[model samples]
Target chain A: MIDVQHLTKRYGRVTAVDDVSFRVEKGEILGFLGPNGAGKTTTMRVLTGYMPPTEGRALVAGHDILEAPLEAKRRTGYLPETPPLYPEMTVRDYLMFVATINGLASAERRRRVETAMERTRVADMASRHCGKLSKGYRQRVGLAQAILHNPDVLILDEPTAGLDPKQIHETRDLIKSLGGDHTVILSTHILPEVAQTCSRVVIINKGRVVAIDTPENLTARLRGAETMFVQVDSAGADATPVIAAVPGVTGVTIAARRDEQASYEVASERGHDIRRQLAAAIVTQGWGLLELRPLRMSLEEIFLQLTTEENAGGAEVPRA
Target chain B: MRNVLAIARRELRSSFASPVAYVAVGLFALVFGYFFYATLVFFAERSLQATQFGMGGPMNVNQMMIRPLMLNVSVIVLFFLPMLTMRAFAEEKRSGTFELLLTRPLTDWQIVTGKFLGAMAMYSLMLLVSLVSILLLFLLGNPEWRQVATSYLGLLLMGGCFVALGLFFSSLTRSQLVAGVLTFSALLLLWVINWTADSAGPVMRAVVQALSITDHFDDFSRGVVDTRHLVYYLSFIGFGLFLTARAIDSERWKG
Candidate 1:
């Protein structure tokens, strides 16, 4: 429901968002992953109609963000990096005010506020002033504000930036549930959050989109070979040769060892399934197999690899 | 219009939630009360002399009392009313609510008008306190209610001008203190712009005198609803609000 075409934003001498283009389908959760100051917020700002792009444009729900801002804004909900909360207003009143400004009918405003609060799990703090709320509550209230209008597109910047592990988990679940009905585009520097919640990841670096694909594709494509970690209690006897002698094993290297236990990272041929062969080899050698698990390349490693590789190999510096 | 009212209501509600509204209104009422007492004493002394010596007929309380009292209020409006509008846009920017406001479906005109309405409401509260002193006059003597009403209209229009100008400065910066200072300076310049007329050339004199904000307010306080002054004040308010809208639009580009 969102189409961005070569959107570029510049602040005088500095280009915050370069010529970047991406499209998000209806009900898809697109994760915008980038390091801090990597122009994620700037890109989101242009998309949400908060600021117009210096060059090119974006369309939200078929309305050009620059030409038909009101229509576009009406269908999109935005939660900025810092949750916009009036510290003096209670959560209920604040949500009500947001509903009114967003042009919700008077008859429907109250119900929408309650539903939004319930969905974000901030209903208990309805009467409490936002200033007194904890960081986690403030963030949830912000989330509630975005969904209160029942907008088609939700733009959240660092939605889970500050929170306990449990709160983060709850927030991720909430965002995951928000999909299918709302096309969500969330930006974060946290790799796991993107991998866990977003259906598609857009890895950005230095104000440019270096990679965009599904989480599975990003990790699997970067691996190039199937690797496994095997730990064996060989009684201090080396098991590298035994693992290396397995039929599909191409290479074996000892990762760690202590006393009678040892760990080896075994590289296997592509499209190979050698778990049974490696197990038989270890058992026949009288080595006790402690642990054997496939080690897929994680999103973190892929993110690092993609972002770091962008400016390498004589990539030119961008100028305004 | 609904969106405008909603934003206006929030602006007024937030002002009262903080101490800014109370302190400004309280200071205004205190100064107004002191002026009312002094002017009443002066009128009482003049009436005593008229009756004792049989010098003339009874005094017109509205002319003698309420007129100068409102003039004093118009002067103080230059000082206190700017505070009402100083945080209209500055605080929103400082607290990051500006993003929420801009991204909403509402137009810049709606937000600016809402802020103006909220600040005018606060200005109205300040004017309402003068009612306490005006109502007391009815307890003992009859004041011309028409004159009283006209004086209020005068103060309202004058304060509206200040409120609009203050909103313009507030939208230009993210600092309330800076907004307040700039508003005060601008009002003071407009106040004294006429002062230069006395020594200026003939053409310069008429322009400066007509451009002075206080000169437009003089007709309203004397119970004269001159359309010229009405148009001037209305246009002044409209232009200030127009500039404020442009400021926000430009801010979006700057960001």
Candidate 2:
């Protein structure tokens, strides 16, 4: 439901968002991952019709963001980096105001506001002023406003930036529940959030979309070899030589030792299952196998590898 | 129009929710009451002097009291209008609500008009407070009601222009203090522009004098509702609001 084509935004001498392009299908939760100052917020801002891009165009629900801003804006709800709130207004009044401005009918406005408040769990604080609420409540109130109108597209920037761990978990669950109905584009520097909540991830670095894929696919593609951590009771007999002697074993390195047990990180060729052969070899050497587990790359590792590796190679390739 | 009203309603509600509206209106009433009392005393003293000299004619309260009070209120608004409008766009930008406002389906003109009307609504309340003092004159004295109404019209129009100008300045900055200071300076400059008329040549003098906001207001305060003066105030308001609309439009590009 969202299409961005070669969108570029420049602030005088500095280009905040370079020529970047991406598309998000209906009901897709696209995680916008980037380091600080990676233009994630800028891209979302352009798509929300908050600011026009310096070059190219963006479409929301089949309407041009620049040419038909009102139509585009009508179908999109945006929660900026900092929640856009009026400190003087109560949570109820603020949401009602948002509902009114969003052009909801009077009869529908009250129901929508109540539903939003209930969903975000701000119903108890509805009468309390926004300024008096804690950071987590404020964030929830912000989410309520964005989802009140039930727009077709939702663009959130750092939705869980200042929340505590529990709040973050609740927010991620809320966002996950919002999928399959509202097309979501959320930006964050948090890697696990993408893995847990988003269906697809777009990793941007230095104002460019360096990598875009599912979290699982990204980790799978980046892992050139399968790795496993194995701990054994060496009994004064080293197991590295025996494990490395297996047919598919690529390499092995001593990891750590506890009492008489030593851990070895074993590497094998991709798509190879060397655990059976390696276990047989260890048994033949009279070494007791204590623990054996495959080491899958975490989203953190995949993110770091993708972002830093691109920077190291100085690749600024413009997406076609 | 519905969107405009919604925005205006929200703005008005938020204004009253804070101390800014109360403080501004309270200060206005205090200053206006003091000026009204001072001007009434001076008119009474002058009338008494005329009676003692056996040259007393009928005392025209509209001419002696209402006219001067209206002018005084205009001057008071020159200082207080910025307080009403400085937060119009400045606070929104500071608190990041400007993004929320612009990202909505409402147009720039709707936002500008809504904010302008909201500020004007508060200003009207300030004027209404002064009306209580004016009503007392009608009850106790035989002031010409037509002239009193005309003076109020003049105040309203002048206040509209002031609000428009203030809103324009507010849109240009994120600092409310800077917006207020800049608006006050701009109004003061316009208020004193007529002072330079004497030093300039005849043609230049006319241009400078015409630009003075108070000069156009003088006709309405005198119970003379000339279309020319009405046109001038309307044009002034239009120009100010037009500039404010343009200022907001530029924000889209600058962002």
Q: In DockQ terms, which candidate is top?
A: 2
lDDT of 2 by residue, A1-320 (tens): 99999999998878999989999999999999989998999999999988889999999999999999999998998899989999999999999999988999999999999999988889999999999999999989999999999999999999998899988988898899898899999999888899989999998887888888888887777777888889899886677788888998878888887778999988888788988988888887888998899988787777776677744212221111
Tens-digit lDDT track for model 1 on B16-52? 9999889988998898899999999999999999989
Write candidate 2's Cα lDDT for B97-210 as tens digits.
999999999888899999988998899899998788888888888888898889889989998999999999999999999999999999999999999999999999999988
lDDT of 1 at A232: 96
Model 1: residue A200 alpha-carbon error in angstroms: 0.9
TM-score of 2: 0.97
Over the stretch A57-166, how does candidate 1's per-residue lDDT look in tens digits? 89999999999999999999999999999999999999999999999999999999999999899999999999999999999999999999999999999999788899
**Model 2 spans > 4 angstroms off:** A311-320, B56-58
Q: Report lDDT (Cα) of residue A141, candidate 2.
A: 94
Share of the reference A-B contacts seen in candidate 2 = 0.90
**lDDT score, candidate 2, position B166:** 96
Candidate 1 lands at a TM-score of: 0.94
lDDT score for residue A275 of model 2: 89
